[model samples]
Target: MNSTVTMIVRLLLAIILLVFGANKFFNFIPMEAPPEGSFMDALIKTGYMMPLIAVSEIIPGFLLLINKWKGLALVWLAPISINIVLFHIAFDISTIAPAALVFTLNTFLIYINWKKFRTLF
Candidate 1:
């Protein structure tokens, strides 16, 4: 892929992730109570812990958007993607589509920037 396209993709990914992450912190998206006995319900049952999860989402999202911490942002992306994918898989497969797309795009972004992450080896 062209470098310009790669950069654009990265920027878009960063924007989307950052906005969504901020939503978790800001509750720009209203929270609905999970259904009784649902996996989400179980998660909510953990109480204050829920906000911590939201923080995890928000922080990485912010990092990605800044673009200065691309490597750290990518590191954070893995767990966030896994959580989103699993949440959809276990709770609501229908909603998984967007998460899947994000995951796919993030994977591509990571691959395109793999050189920056090479120091981890």
Candidate 2:
């Protein structure tokens, strides 16, 4: 992708990560409770899981926003994005759009930066 498109995607992903990540801690954006006995409910019940996820998101978000260690940031976000998509697909299909966006953006970033990551193989 061109630099402008890459930057836009990075910024969009960063904003999304920051907002949703902060929400996990502050609950500033109201959301419906997860369904009973669902995987989401189980995750919330763990107490630490949500905060951990918040940190995972926020750190990479800042990295992406600042255009620092972006390859690493995208790598760090990959699994979280996958889990987000999988969770939505399995538990709550109605809210899958954001998850899909995250996954797509992360995947695209990773693809464009594949050269930086090739040495790891």
Give one clash count per candidate, in the order shown. 0, 0
TM-scores of the candidates in the order shown = 0.80, 0.94
What is the TM-score (0 to 1) of candidate 1?
0.80
Q: What is the lDDT of residue 30 in candidate 2?
A: 89
Expressed as tens digits, the lDDT of each residue in 35-108 for candidate 2 is 89878899999999999999999999999999999988998999999999998888789999999999999999
Give the least accurate 10-residue stretch of model 1, judged by summed lDDT: 18-27
Model 1 root-mean-square deviation: 2.2
Off by over 4 Å in 2: none
Note the residue pairs that clash in candidate 1. Answer: none
The positional error of residue 76 in candidate 2, measured at the CA in angstroms, is: 0.5
Best by TM-score: 2
Q: lDDT (CA) for every model shown? A: 0.76, 0.95
* Window of ten residues with lowest summed lDDT in model 2: 32-41
